[model samples]
Target chain A: MISLAGRDILHAWGKFVFTGVGLGLLIGVTLTMAGVYRGMVDDAKALLDNSGADLWVVQKDTLGPYAESSSIYDDVYRGILGMPGVERAANVTYLTMQVRRGESDVRAMVVGVVPGGPGEPGQPGYLVAGRRITRGHYEAVADIATGFQLGEQIQIRRNLYTVVGLTRRMVSSSGDPMVFIPLKDAQEAQFLKDNDAIVQQRRRTAENPAFNRPGVPGLLNAAIASQSANPYVNAVLVQIEPGYSPDDVAEPIRRWKRLQVYTREQMEKILVGKLIATSARQIGMFLVILAIVSAAIVAFIIYTLTLGKVREIAVLKLIGTRNRTIAFMILQQAVGLGVIGFVVGKISATFWAPIFPKYVLLEPGDAARGFVAVVVICVLASVLAIRAALKVDPAEAIGG
Target chain B: MLTKGIRINGLKKRYGKGETAVDALKGVDMQVAPGEVVGLIGPSGSGKSTLLKCLGAVIEPTAGQMTLGDEVIYDDGWKISDLRALRRDKIGFVFQAPYLIPFLDVTDNIALLPMLAGHPNNESRQRALELLKALDVAHRARAMPSHLSGGEQQRVAIARALINRPPVILADEPTAPLDSERALAVIRILNQMARQYETAVIVVTHDEKIVPTFRRIYHIRDGRTNEEAGEGRAFE
Candidate 1:
């Protein structure tokens, strides 16, 4: 038999297509919301991947240095380097701030990396343009997402450093682009006070008799100079020797070194599970609401369409059309509408994803799931219309 | 002799229980022979609709016996387990409003009955084409119901009812929406189709315009029927 539903849709294609487009746009927003959540998780993973660390050693008992503030002495990596199975360790500090470029500024995570050759744990893995940070004090390597060009001088706190290299996908867990500068420069930028505060500190030390007794004249100046320098780093990144498990190296540090150490898996849990959990929940709620709205729209549309055919349906029944046949026609129409909406939604989501400010990672797996969900929703939504159609008495066609 | 058509005996239908009971059909009895067309006339609130519903097998009769061709279809209760199959294979129905499926073309609308009875598409459509030619609607075979005029649509509807060559057809005001001339035309076509297919046709109508066209008619009143002879006027 010819498809009754298909003929009906073709007969009024403009109505079906326009309604599908409207539903498609709503589905697009739902898909984009899921993509946003995936992007957040991807950003967190990218942060860890680019760092090239097997383990992270932070201040004891802290969730940081990504999810929270963490501080340890810059010399902490020296002690971690001597542990068994530890191949390399580097001091790294993260300070999220707005770095100035000409007149405007960009929010970036300024990372302090040891001025070493390639393969340092905290240094950017590879440069896309120019060269890595070769100068110990005044050079910077920035992620291309920061919109910085090669040889551009950017102000980080009081000092100006030339951007010498560019990298891609190097972002902090919060999705801010990373700019790598020499360890000492990042330290000073992180902790240095203005000259006025420094001068006031020196006078305050001099007025104190404990430091400036008449016999010890230089003790006051030495104490004031020590107070002005910063020796703290956010965390130490450690790379274990080949064939050695990170858990092996991290266990001793956690047990003996009086510091918090996390293996790669544990840190991923912290970043994805704890750091972005609330945001994921919020997106999940939006997806649920959009699904319900989509179901409601499909149900209402199908019900109205069926009601319009009451006379025809009664005749069909009187002339011996099966209940299953009538039910199937309505079902096929609903699923057809869902298929149209899905195609439009997928295209719209792909087109608009890049325009979003944050990363929107649209995974193929998620899309497949979304398509199945839409079909199921359409089938469920068609129930109301099918019931209404089936209840139409064939006797009504005879006209009482 | 009992002919190859429809035979009804003591057909009854009641709505609700004691104290509020309403008998819609009070022992309706009628017969229409093959190759003959008959009219059933009644006033409002008469048993016309209830009897039609009973003949169509759309509703169960409280007590009755009905025979189509050689088969006993109803006796106090349904003798056939599948009333839907009975309606599809042994009975045909035509409504006041043509009610051709709007989405379907003229050909498919007529062919749908045979298709529903498991005929292949090509065969069903072939049968429909033959009937459409007989009904003089072969030119508009591809036209949708909306594009057809009222007279054309009713003709197509008659063609649909005759497609399966069922033993009996129940027509409920087949020409109510047409003018007197068109109404006469419909009656003429129904009479021709009934004779050509050797099918029994019972037309339920209140239109005086085409009532005289029937040679015999059954007038229903107060849930009962009385047989009468019609003018048998020719359609000119």
Candidate 2:
């Protein structure tokens, strides 16, 4: 039998093509929304992966470092390094703030790591350009996403650091690019008050008589020096020995060190399941709304197309056309529209993904699911048109 | 005696119920033989459309016996199990406006009926082409309905009606949209197709120009039919 739907589409292909283009743009936005959610999860994983840590040691009883604020003494990692199954542990601090470059500033996750080589757990794994930081102060390794080049100088808070290296995909859980500075600079940046406030604090400390005894002449100066410096870090990144499991090492640190310890799996859960869970739900709500809107648009378009052919449909029915044939014709047209829209949508999403501010990871698996979903939606959307076509009376063809 | 063409005995149809009931077709009796074309003429309120719908099996009759060939299709109630199949295989229809499917070309429009009845695609198109040639529309076989002239479209419509070779064809105002010459041409094509296919035809029209071409005509007034003689073969 001749395909009634195909012939109709060919006869008015301009209409179908234009409508499909419009619907395809909507599908593209829907796909991009899903990709955004995927990108958030990937960024969180990349943050953990690039840190090169087998475990996270933070302040006791806190989620810390990524999802919450964590403060521990700067000397904590030294104690953790001597434990059995502990290959290496390094002090690390994270502070999300805008870093200035020349005239403009870019949002970045300012990380503080010891002036260690590539093997350190908290240091950036590899640099795409220039050398890793070998200087103890005022040297930085910046993620390429921060738009910093080799030898470029950037200001972290009160001090300026030279961007000595650049790495890729080194971002925080929030998708901000990481700018690696020396541990001491980050401690002062995160904890120390301004110079004016420090001077005022020192003056106040001297006025207190408790530390001003005549027998202890240098005691007040020592107390003032201590008050002017910062001695805290955010967390310690630990790497277990090759023969040992992360849980095996992490448990001892939790008990003996009296600090919160998280294995790799637990940290992943904290980042994905807890940190970005709300964003995932928000994206999910947008997906549901987009799906409903797509379904409704398809239904309206199909229903309108069917009504336009009411006269032909009545004549078909009068000429002994079966209800199923009429219904199938409408269904074929709807699915055809969906197929065209999906092709355009996939192409549109691919072309525009890179230009987005954050990474938009369009996985093949998501495309497959989106195609199936579009087909199912088209089938369901055709129901209203099919019902209307089936209800047409053959007698309408022979009017009184 | 019952004929092998088509005959209706005491056909009746009503609309609504109780006080709002309407007896549109009080009782319609008519006969058209194979190899013959007859006209059904009436005023606006007459039962011509009502009887045409009944004969086409598009609407059920209140009480009647409708026969096609040697089969009693309706006796008070329908005797056929599948009315749709009966309509597809045993009857054909033409409408006032040609009403060809606009999406399809001339050939597929004519061939659609036989295809719907499960005929092979090549065979149906072959039959359709032969009818198109016979109706002098073979040159426009691939043209879509929208591209065809009114007279050409009507000829295609006639080819479509005859494509399935059904025993009976009910044409409602098949030439109403045409001028005098095209109208006569349509009536001539109907007569030729009816005789060539051995199918009976009943045309419902108010066109005075082509009314005299029929050898027999049925004039319906107030749900009753009166047989009259036409000026037969007045085409020349």
Candidate 3:
């Protein structure tokens, strides 16, 4: 027998196509939402990967230098370097701030890395363009996402640094691009007072009778010098030797060094499980709402389409058409509409993902699952229309 | 009782109970032999629709005996298990509006009956094509129902009814929507199709133009039927 549903769709293809297009846009937004969540997770992972460290040593009783604020002495990595299985250890600081270039400000994670060549922990892994920072002060390596070009000067706090290199995918867990500068400069930018404050502090010390009894002349200057310097770093990035497991290197740092040490897996848990957990839930709520709206739209559309064919259904019933046959026809039409919508949605997501400010990763697995979900949703949504169609009395066709 | 065509004996259909009891068909009795065309005429609410519904198996009679050909289909209770299948195979129906499946072309609309009865697609189409040819609508076989004129759609409906070669056909005001000329033409086609397929046809109509074409007519009033001879005018 000819396909009753196919013929009906062809008969009114303009309406079907228009409805499909409308549904497709909704599906596109849903896919994009999912991609945004995926991008967050990916950024978190990229932050960890670009660090080139198997273990992270932060202040005790803290979650991270990423998820939360953490501070360790700038010299703490010296002890970690002597530990067993320790290959290299470097201090790093992370501060999310708006760095200025020309007139516009780019929100980025300001990273302070210890002076090191390529392949060092806490340094950008590779550069996409230009060269990595060779000098310790007023030189910066910025992620391409920061919209910073090489040889351009950007202001971070009171210091102006030239962007010497551009890296790709180096971002904080929050998806802010990372701007790398020397560890000493970042420490001063993070904690050191301004020139006015330092001068005022020195004058205040000179007027103090406790230090100027005419007996401790050098003592006041020595105290002032200590206050002028910043000796704290956010965290110590530890690189383990080839033969050492992350857990092995991290345990000793936590035990003897008396600091919170997180392995790669533990850090990932902190980033994904704690840092962005609420955002993921928010997106999940959006997904649920979108699904409900999608199902409602499908149900309403299918119901209206079936209503238009009430006479046809009545005639089919009067002519001894089985209830299942009529139900199947409506069901097939709904699924066909979903299939078309899914194709359009996939294309729309792919076309628009790159334009988003944050990285948007649309995985194939998500697309496949979305397709199945669309089909299942369409099938379920068609139930209302099917019930309405089946309730149509065959006697209606023979009108009084 | 002769074992052929359609027979109805003492058929009754009453709605509600006690004070609200309204009898639509009270002891309706009628019979039509194979290849015979009978007309059922009645005034509004005179139980013509009730009797037609009972004969079409759309509504069950309160107490009655209904036979199609050699089968006893209804005797107070349904003898056949699936009334839908019985309707598809043993009875054909042509409504006033033709009621063709609008999405289907003329050929599939007519072929659907035989296809539903388990005939192969090609064979059903072949049978439908032959019937369309007989009804003089063969040229419009592939045309959609919407594309066909009223006369063409009516002819396709006649072809659909005769495709199964059923022994009985129930036509409810088959020519009510047509003008006099088209009305007479539809009745003439029904007559020719009935004789050609050796099927009995019962046409319930109010069209006076086509009423006299039947050899025998049944007049119903106040839930009762009386058989009478028609003028049986020759067709043009």
Which candidate leads in lDDT? 1
Count residue pairs with overlapping backbones in model 2.
Answer: 0
* lDDT for each residue of candidate 3 in A57-106, tens digit (9 for 90 to 100): 99999997888889889898999999999999999999889999988899
**Clash-forming residue pairs, model 3:** none
Residue-level lDDT tens digits of model 1 in B114-201: 8988899899999999999998999999999999999999999999999999999999998899999999999999999999998999
- Least well predicted 10-residue stretch by lDDT in candidate 2 chain B: B1-10
True contacts kept of each: 0.67, 0.69, 0.34
* Number of colliding residue pairs in each model: 0, 0, 0
Chain A TM-score, cand. 1? 0.96
Report the Cα lDDT for residue A302, model 2.
Answer: 99
Supply candidate 3's per-residue lDDT for A146: 89
Query: Model 1: which residue pairs collide?
Result: none
Ranking according to DockQ, highest score first? 2, 1, 3
Candidate 2 share of real interface contacts: 0.69
Ranking by lDDT: 1, 2, 3
Compose the digit string of candidate 2's lDDT tens values, residues B1-236. 64668998899999889999888888888889998899999999898888988898888999978999999999999898888888878888989998999999999999998888788989999999999999999999999999999999999988888887899999999888999999988988888888889999999999998888989999999988999988896853
**lDDT for each residue of candidate 2 in A259-367, tens digit (9 for 90 to 100):** 9998889999999999999999999999999999999999999999999999999989888888999999999999999999999899999999999989888999999
Best by TM-score: 2
In model 3, what is the error at residue A329, expressed in angstroms?
A: 0.5
